[model samples]
Target chain A: MALHPYDPVAGAALRNVPLAEVDSKDRSLALSRPWQLRPSLLASIASHGILTPLRLRPKQNGLMQVVHGFRRFEAARRLGLPSIPGLVLASRNLLKLFLQALEEGRTARTLSSLENAAALRTLKYRFNVPEKRLIEEFLPLLDLKENRRTLRLHLDLAVLPDALQQALERGLENETALRLSGRPEDFQSLCCRLILSFQLGKNRQKKLVEMLDEILAAASKQEVQSVEEVWRELGCAALENRADLTPADRWKRILALLRQARYPALSRHQARFDELKAALKLPPPVRLQAPRYFEGSSLEISMTVREARQLDGLARELKRISGSQEWEELFRLL
Target chain B: MQPYKPEKVFVERAVAESVITRNVLGNLPMAQVEWIDEAGQMVDKSRRWNPSIARAKQSLVLARHPGRFFKPCPAGTTKTGRRNVCCNYFVVNFASNCHMECSYCYLQAYLNLPYMVVHANVEDLLDELGQVFSSNPRSHYRVGTGELADSLALDSLTGYSRPLVEFFAGFTNAALEFKTKSNCVENLLQLDHRGRTVVSWSINPPTVVQAEEHKTASFEQRLAAAEKCSAAGYPIVFHFDPLIHYPEWEKDYRSLVEEIFQRIPPRSVPWVSLGALRMPPRLKALVRERFPRSGLPLGELLPTEDGKLRYFKPIRVEMLSKMRAWITAASPQTRIYSCMENTDVWQKVFQSQQPPSEVELGDSLLQLL
Candidate 1:
């Protein structure tokens, strides 16, 4: 069998290192490793012990620093294991060590979008990888388009605040999070809070983000300075006192306020239409429809009939509706 | 005029032999090039392409149009006893998509191509136009290139208008119109148009342009360009289509009309069209998705008989009546007409209960030429 030159175990010794003596100073740049430990992995480590050895290198302080297997070290410490199996490497190539950790993460299915972005950043800044290679080679590794635009969006996602990153990790969509991140920093936190409080699904989160963005644009057009001002003008705080409303209901109310702010004409048209509909009070079988956007000069009245008697009944209903002044007003509105 | 700089250029192998394709490639010297054997394959591949990122990067495609280059306008007869179709109006599609983004643009729903495509086979288009023109030499034809793409938006790179203007110059029966929201008329100014080409602008109020028409020339810029065209012995036209119903719209539109007449002579402006903001039912969702901050699609819209969404009749009447009044006051000699409107709207707007015959309306516009 041929020995691979880049094997992790090549010229390295496997030994049990005390978990307390392992330093994580250089771990901040590890792209593949997640910040928070997984409960399933912790439970597995507690029951079956560490199967893979942690990759470690010696530091100037003489304490071994973790190069990979950060989760395993944390889990072992939590399990009260004084020492964990570690592979001690003599090499100090950060890029090679980071790639090795990334490979392990791929095998373990732990590398997320954030991790992918971080790896691309490390390759670009620390290792001086060309942007062309990053876009063409690294973006596809994360199932993103092999383009500079996607690369930039993923890079933007990498530096988001920790809370938003955690939310992303907990399954808020990357696109939704990206949209939220495009807002002002103050609005981003407020939006994230609303999203977390309601526990919105991906579609709802997208809608919320869109509605918030529209509100912001409207406020900007109105010369309102901040989202805080929008919130105050919209009376968003009053939603808190509606104790009977569920989170979804509260979210709906908030979205309605935003929509009203965004589309003043549509709101007014809707109110007038509702008033007209109420005034018409047509029979159950009859329906009156107006042209869309109110841009065309046509109104349609539809009705259903089963027999001659029903036809006569519909005609009488139509006559009654026609006789009402609301009919004239409706035509005038049209 | 500032030429459009596509980030990447894709040339179809079929159009590689075309002169227009070579011209486009030469114009965009720094663009990354890709060659494909079939234009359909490229179109199919672009269906999955995300324009949000690509458009931000200014990536574009230059390919040959695989289908017919010339076709009649689709604004056919409506159920409301109105001839919505413009008689004898034909479209010469030099391109498929626009680089500019308007919130209420129907192209957002109409075009599926992810990138802006300039059809490279313009010589073939001219040949087709020749056949149509010769087949009906007696009838006056209103041919336009702005149906799908903005006519002047890519004129600097494509140089399509020069040949088109020169082609129509020989014909007394045919006139070419280039409708656009762009100010790229510098190329057209130097051409021997011979009063055969009409350079028109799709204008709106400054506020509406700012809010909805993204990456487009400002209203003042468009007006200045129109004034230049008018001075350069070319007939000018104005289209105030997709007139948005917003707060202070009357004030905005009135001032817009005043500005137009104040700048360009009304005698040079032969026609002015008014079309209210209306879209198909499916376009509402697309607009909301593509332009999340746009309030244009949130108007009080209901489906009309032809399956397009439009405003209620009274709203349309009010907008058109006010526009007609303002436009007439500004320039009484400028002919005003409505596009895609029914007979009732025409009667209400023109203050004539009797609907005019389609022939009369068509002749009225033709007389301007």
Candidate 2:
């Protein structure tokens, strides 16, 4: 079979291919990059056809498979075009095809972490690329560590459910998504929805995931049978009426609940400390502070006095407070 | 003695020419060896480093000490006394991690590096210690090597204990303790320590050992090894630290104490310390993550004033007081102290809030010498 030379450098050829006849099957091996119909791009293509041709290979059927230009093909189909311009190729080399598509995609727009993971997965399973080569050669090519542990983590993220994977693509950090994936499947979906809807940043996302993990650990220790029961036990309904609260405030409340569940003793100590601090209302100038974590045996009371009169006033207040039973109880708590 | 078998050996280029490095490499012939330069680049760098899985599977690393070899132990203060009570206690860093997988081990959180690293420069460590001992002629020093790594777990591979024991033998005022849960004492048996070396075992009930201490010697094996060391004229110490509160804990602990006194003479065991189970708040998550089935973190723990989670004061007092009585009945002459315990706990357990000062403690320990 004498085939014409396909420009490997430019890697595209202009040809008319029927939109209906372009086979998008076998896309399981295509890097599963998320596609959203950007109105601007659609309108531009609608006004003046696709400037770049779709990359396609002839299938066993009469149809040609669109390998690199999924978005352009979809837009052409939406515009009711009978045929679109495409780059005709004559090879079934999956690895070569993937690299070309990835290169073109990279030049056009930045690929998300999940997109990179999908490409790595295709190279791994479809091309049978060894893990060593994938981590050392291919991952560094994608600006990732040449380490097996990190490769495995990303590959795990690639196989997550669509909603979670989409959330990861939407700006969740790889580590945060991985942490969420550690939860039970149903709980992972719920967390993914909450995280995406709330639009949490990296720090808040990490906190939410950590709080979820702590709550789950406590529930598991208590032998709670279901996630619903755990959520109910945490009184998650209280968050419903907090519509006025900002996302950070809501996250703080959720964290407080998890902290109370995880460290009941610390919570009790904090409550007691707060009560004591409120009851012992000394002068505003006299600052009283308890040790952090209540792990110390002393409370620090301080006041800056510039005059002898001020010193005597402070001394008198201290003497009066020293006789109170609250002082005794506070020290005993310490 | 169990032989040290590391999966991969990384040598710093600065120490690649040292005899200890060569000897260690020659010992582990089958381990993959690579020389890393100052930039942390391996000579034959490949993508074969699977540190996470290898660490989980107990990989070991042999490297040189990068900086100072000795560090003074922190003068950990208690509620009663905010004083430096360590009394010249120091730790030598010959190793950085342990192979044993105790569920409650703080190393899971402390060590950032996954592989067990053994610092190969023992001569440098000895030289540094000799200077300290020579400069401070009047003070008695209690030095140990088990702070970061088990003392004897890799003694057979490195032969660290022999040189350490031999070094301390010449000093009448300094003592070296090899604290471990392993039964690797064959190297110690051959050395003429002259009572300068103390072999201490971190002991627990057999059930706890089986449930929590993975890959460590069984209680019976540990006690048998302790008896062997005692017979060899080495002062013996036992530490019942992190005493867990489990079902029928009293019965278990009592039997453990009885078993210890039955096998060896109590007079030979000079020091026995009891510390109830406690951990930093951050460590609980690590424990649960590493050992999912572990119930150690699910106990009735309370936050103390020191930011550590411990059993309630009354619970700790009861546990300590009961253990004290059992040990006293078994060996009245044995001196028992509490590790990291506060003044109130010491008072409640020992009937005296004013325990011996650091010098007094040092003098009493020297009596065993």
lDDT of 2 by residue, B1-369 (tens): 234477767777767665567667776788887666641342122224534523533555566676887777643664434442334467887887788878898777776566677787778889998998899898788888998899998776677787889999989878998999999998888788988889999999989998899888999889999999989988898989989987689999999999899888887888788899988878977787778778787665767755577886656778999999999999998888787776656766788847777677766776666
lDDT per residue (tens digit) for residues A1-334 in model 2: 3222645734345688877788755466456543555678789999998887777877788888777877677677777989998778766685787688888787667776777888888888878999889988888888888887878887888887776777776777777777766668777765676677678788877767766666676568658657666766787646734899987777677767767876666687677877987787787778888766554557899898889998899889889888887888887766
Clash number for model 1? 17
Q: Model 2: how large is the Cα RMSD against the reference? A: 6.4
- RMSD after CA superposition, every candidate: 7.0, 6.4
Candidate 1 stretches with Cα past 4 Å from truth are A1-14, A28-35, A38-63, A75-159, A280-322, B1-68, B73-88, B93-125, B147-163, B180-196, B204-234, B242-248, B262-268, B276-317, B331-333, B340-364
DockQ score for model 2 = 0.17
Alpha-carbon TM-score of each model against the true structure: 0.71, 0.74
Cα lDDT of model 1 by residue, A237-306, tens digit: 5784478898778878887776677556666776787798888888788787876555445688888777
Indicate which candidate wins on TM-score.
2
How does chain B of model 1 score on TM-score? 0.93
Error of 2 at B158 (Å): 6.3
Q: Write the per-residue lDDT of candidate 1 for residues B260-299, one digit (tens) a residue.
A: 8998998998888898888886787678667877877656
